[model samples]
Target: MVEPFRVVDLADWTRGESEPGGAEEKRWFTAPDASSQSGRWLFKPRRIKELTLSRQRRARGDAPDLLVRGEDWAEKISYELARLVSVPAVETELATVVRRGTEEAVLGSMSRDMRPERWGWTPGAALLAEHDDDFDSELSRGHSLSAVLTVLAPMNGPVGTEFHSWPAFDVFAGYLVFDALVANTDRHAHNWGVLQNPTTGVVCLSPSFDHGSALASGNGDVFRADRVRSGAVQQWCSRGVTKRFDGGVAVGLVDIAMQALSLASADARRYRRDRIVGLNLDLCDDVINAAPNLSDHTRTFVQIAVATNRRRLIDALH
Candidate 1:
């Protein structure tokens, strides 16, 4: 079963003027470096007198601030599905905000700032630079999955002694499997990273985030309904391609997973495959069924699309 996420009715909060005290007084941080294509704002809720209550509402454990992005509900659904399958993902919530005096419900995903005063995180692109001198020039031409794997594989073995014992490689491989299952096409270099523990000197892969691009988020209800009614759901799955690698080349999401699996070590491969096998489609259906304000046509389309993609992923594993 998937864990329940806290849903905040921003409309009610705004109307009641009961939004967290001092929310208006708090300074919002700018995030120009964030890779999200949508607008993002950094928010920190004022600490409540009750400690337990404060922790519960906090985005991540002990982190006082969260990066809030304006997104479609796809990120919320993707985050829920990721949790259902036990994949590490950032926590998200559904919120309604008044924009220009017009109220609209929007999906807001909050990520804890990994840089907590001392600890620092490194983006995949920066990590890749340590291995290849021509990283920037090559990226300007086209980024390929093969190139990424080639750089990351060394961390798993005798060559990169610094990360030989770390679980970064395995975690990254699992992320690729999750992305494949969700048809996420935006796993760009800046989207993933590794966090360093300032006190313990330990390093690990960061939990996955920025998934608004997945699940055909750009598709409208009309397009999805037409595809479902025409029985072209399979065609839609086949047409789903990743925006990363080879200059956003059009390649099937499953194919990307297969390639990533092939490049992974035996242990990494097993980890990814096990996670994929553990996916609960029934829970997925329940999630779709419980989605708030979803149209019947969209619900049906999402169900079919998820089922088709799940089958394709499982079949590829075999």
Candidate 2:
């Protein structure tokens, strides 16, 4: 089974106070080359990831790679999209970012005190000292796979997590539609998870996180038509869809839902298999049906993804 994990080290990034309680925040860091540091950290854990709002505001042409792409709604939009698409990720919540006082920075807690062994939490103390001079340059491998699984995981589980439990047919189909409408392309390893609560016996996947890349005003890597044109490539590289904030106004809610329809159509193979990835399909259907409160636009998007998935689900569920 895949183990539970969180980021304990921030030495590479600035030593900022995470949100109250356990909500992690991005701690800014200076790049070895001050200018280059502004780029992006290709691969990162979504729960503990950080980006500069101020830097995003200062951006010139294309949106800065590291900033939350949308405004305050970035989290809201992405979270709803995940629910619609049926991908699993961390719970999304707003948290504060604070630069730790010098005393806290210098006389940090010891690693042993932080308990790196139990729960697999790396100590937050020494991270400041050991982090790279160029912190943002670090990229995680297999981000492509991460993106695909964000919403379309195999339900068979990735290598790290062996337990697999996708839901009943109706539920899985509903989420697929939700994700397609939202166009959540940033489905990488750092954002999604596979785990269960022991007492509840519920092997639930986390809700979506790090969806700041959706619905932008310019062209982004994820928004490119060529990426999903070839059915095989969309299925094969479905795992790595980190959006580069490339969407123009044309690709908003309407465009995204349409794109999802086409993308899913190209590779019915993957969509057909992923209908019940994380939860029971019955529960999924219940959630979608109850979500009548979702905005009309969002609802329309879900309808499109689900309509196409129903037939496939019936054939497979039997």
Candidate 3:
């Protein structure tokens, strides 16, 4: 079982503040372009000097800041599960905020700015632009997975080395497997990217982030309960499709994973198969159960959904 690196109760951060001030203030400039109904704010806490110092030392940058999302817990759970499977994922914690004198708890995930002084970050969209002149329009119309693969497959090698000799393709394939297992439908162009070392010009796939849409985040408690009671978890999971690839075609997540796996080189396919087969579901259960703040109904639903998806993925490999 994987334990969260940290679990913060936000009440500590908001205790004395009568209103949103000090560290509770939002940094409006850092918001990324995405469709999230929940309000997001870049929070820099004043009390956690240790956290701030650690983030700065690791990234060789400033203090670590949190991207807090109101009324959302999916990111926290998703981060935990991703870490459990040894996938690169952002760290997250549950927090309570006092806004307008009303106390509410939300999920706050940590982020290291990709734009360090010496390094740079590139979104998948920019990477795709290297290959397709009409990348933007093509992306808007959907079915752009092939275009993305075309760009990423070639970046598999070490800097100044043979491009075809590396495992970057396999690493990305592993991400698809993670998405399928979690039923993440939002692996959009902007969601994945590469971290580039400006000094060396060496680029590697970025760690997975922005997973607020995974694990049926949009489903209500009542709907999730109904599905669980009816034993329709598998059917429901199968019906989970991604909007990232198909604008309106309703392409299933598992189908997308299968397609990506098939397109991958033999070595990449074998790597993904071994990784997925080796994941520990019991550890996943422990992580889910450890989230005391999560509602029982939601927890139960997540447990069943993960189990169903794991079986579905294992079956797909055969």
* lDDT of predicted model 1: 0.61
Worst 10 residues of 3 by lDDT: 14-23
| Estimated TM-score for each candidate | 0.70, 0.31, 0.71
lDDT of 1 by residue, 1-318 (tens): 434454443332212122232223222233333323122332322122222437566645564533222234567788788887666776555543443344433344433333445777777777766766666623433356666665555343211223246445565666777887777877877777666668876656667776766766556566677887898878888788775666556777888778877766787676667666777778888877765666777778777877788788888988
Q: Which stretches of candidate 1 lie over 4 Å from their true place?
A: 1-6, 9-70, 99-107, 112-117, 137-142, 150-166, 200-202
Task: Report the lDDT of model 2 for residue 294.
Answer: 36
* Poorest stretch of ten by lDDT in candidate 2: 107-116
CA lDDT, every model vs. true structure: 0.61, 0.32, 0.63
Root mean square deviation (Cα) for candidate 2:
15.9
Task: Summarize candidate 3's per-residue lDDT along 1-318 as a digit string, tens digits.
Answer: 445345443443322212232224432112223412122333332222232456447678665654222224566677777766656664455543443454534334433333345667777877776676656633545337677677776466323223224556656666778888888887877778887878778777776776666777656556667887887877888888876774445677788888888877887677667767777878778877776555676778888888888888888987
What candidate 2 gets wrong by more than 4 Å, as runs, is 1-72, 81-179, 196-204, 217-318
| Alpha-carbon shift of residue 74 in model 1 (angstroms) | 1.1
